[model samples]
Target: MRSISVKIVIKTFLLVLVFGIFSKIYGQTDLAVKQKSNFWKQVQFGGGFGLNIGTGFTDVTLAPNAIYNLNQYLALGAGLQGSIVSQKDYYSSAIYGVNTIVLINPVEEVQLSIELEQVRVNNTFRNPTTGIVKDNFWNTGLFVGGGYRMENVTMGMRYNLLFNKDKNVYADAMMPFIRVYF
Candidate 1:
C-alpha cells in the first residue's frame, strides 16, 4: 500500500511540470514583443530659456532638447539653441547652435555628462568713428562635467575643453548649469 501511494504522488508532480512548460504556446506576450512595444516610453523631453533686459542691453535665449534612456545607467540626446543679444549701438549678435550629449549615471544621485556643440555667430559692432563692422565665425565647444541629481532635476558645473579667449562667446571656461527633464 505504501509503494502505491508513492507512485500516485510522482505522477501528479510530473503532470504539473508539463503544463507549465506549454503555457506560452500562444507566443504573443513573449519578451521580445513586449520590449518593442514599450520603446516610446523611454524618451524624455527637457530644455530651458533665458531673458535678460537692462539699461541699453537685451539678451534672449531658447534651447530645447530630448533624450532616450536606454536604461538606468545610460542616456543619449540632442539639443538646439538660439540667442539674440543687443546693447545700445555698441554691439549686436545672433547665435545659433546644435548640441549632442551623453550621460552616465554611476549612482542614483550622481551623474556624469559630456556634450559637443557647434555654433554660428554673427556680430555687428558699431563705433561712432568706425561705423558698422560685421564679423561672422563658428565656435565649437566640448564640455565635460558631473552633477548632483534630484528626481528630474540636476545642477552642476562644466568646463569647456575648447575655450578661446579672443573669439569665444562665454567669458570663462567653467560655467554652472541647471537641467530638468519630464
Candidate 2:
C-alpha cells in the first residue's frame, strides 16, 4: 500500500513537470506568431490575360485571381479562367475551375507553387451545310502546375492529360499559362 502511494505521487509530479514545460513552449510560440502577423497582411489581388496559339489552333483566355497570405511563408488564392478554342473543323468553349494556388516564396519576389484545378471543354463538330451533327461533347480534367514570381507579377505553365476514355478518345491536352500577380 505504501509503495503504491509513492508510485502515484511520483507519477503525478512527473506529469505536472511535463505540463509546465509544454505550457512554456506554447507561450513562446504564441509570442512569435503575434510578432509576425503584420507581415502576412501584405497580400494583394491580381491576374492576367494571355493568348494561346498552338498546333493548328488559337485561343484567347483570361484569368483573374486574388491572394491572401496565411502566414509569412504561405498564401492562397482562387480565380476564374476561360477560353474560346478554335480548331480547323470544330469550335469549343473551355472553362477553368476555382484555380487554387499555394504560394511558397524561397526568396524576395520569387515563389514556387503547387496548383490543383479542373478544366472544362465543350465542342461542336458538325457540317455547317449538311446539318448533320457529328459530335457535341463536354469534359473535365485534373492538372498540376507551377510558377515563378518576379516583383508584382508571376509567370507559369502546367499540363493536363484528360482521362475521359469514353467520349474523349483523343482528348488529351497541354496548356502553358502566363499571369501578372499584384
Candidate 3:
C-alpha cells in the first residue's frame, strides 16, 4: 500500500513538472503576440516556472496566465499556478492559486509590474516513527510581488502570507521569465 501511494505521488509530480516545462517553452514561442486596431502588441499572455527554496524545503511552481493591456501604463491578468514541494518531515504536498498582475511602463526598455495572488494549500504530513498520517490542512493566503521587464525577459520577486493562524508562514521567492510575442 505504501509503495503504491508513493508511486502515485511521484507520477503526479512528474506530470506537473512536465506541464511547467511546456508552459515555459510555449510562452517563449511566437504565438503569444496579439494584434489590435492599428498596432502590433507584445505578448498578451505569459507563463513561467519558478523554484522556491526555504529552510528545510524546496518547491517548484508551474504558473500560467494571460494579461490584457488596459493602456500604456496599466495591465491586468490572472493565472492558475500549482506547486510541488519537499518538506522537512519527508512529506510532500501541493498547492494551487490564482494570481493577478498590474504593469507600469516608465520607459521603452523598462517595465515595472506588481502581482497579487491568492492560493490554497493542501498538505499532508506523516509520522516517521509510526508511519501514521498525522497532519493535513487546507490554507489560503495572499502574495505580493513586483517585476522588471527588459525586452523579452522579465524578472520579479514576491512573498506569500499564509492566512491560517496555525500556518502563519511566509514565503519569499523570485521569478524570471522570457517570452516572445508574435
Q: Pick the candidate with the highest TM-score.
A: 1
Q: lDDT per residue, candidate 1, 1-182, as tens digits?
A: 99888998888888877876676554545766778768768888998899999999999999998989999999999999999999997999999999999988999899899999999999999999999999999999999989999988999989999999899988999999999989
The lDDT per prediction is 0.91, 0.67, 0.65
User: How many steric overlaps are in each model, in order?
Assistant: 0, 0, 0
Q: Residue 163 error for model 1, in Å?
A: 0.6
lDDT of 3 by residue, 1-182 (tens): 99999999999999999999999887766354433432335337667777989899898988887777677666667788888887887777777778777666676555666666666666666777767464444445454545566664556555554334556324334334453221
Clashing residue pairs, backbone N/CA/C < 3 A, model 1: none
Residue 14 local lDDT, model 3: 100
Q: By descending lDDT, how would the candidates be arranged?
A: 1, 2, 3
**Cα displacement (Å) at residue 105, model 1:** 0.9
Better of 1 and 2 by lDDT: 1
TM-score of every model versus the real structure: 0.80, 0.54, 0.55
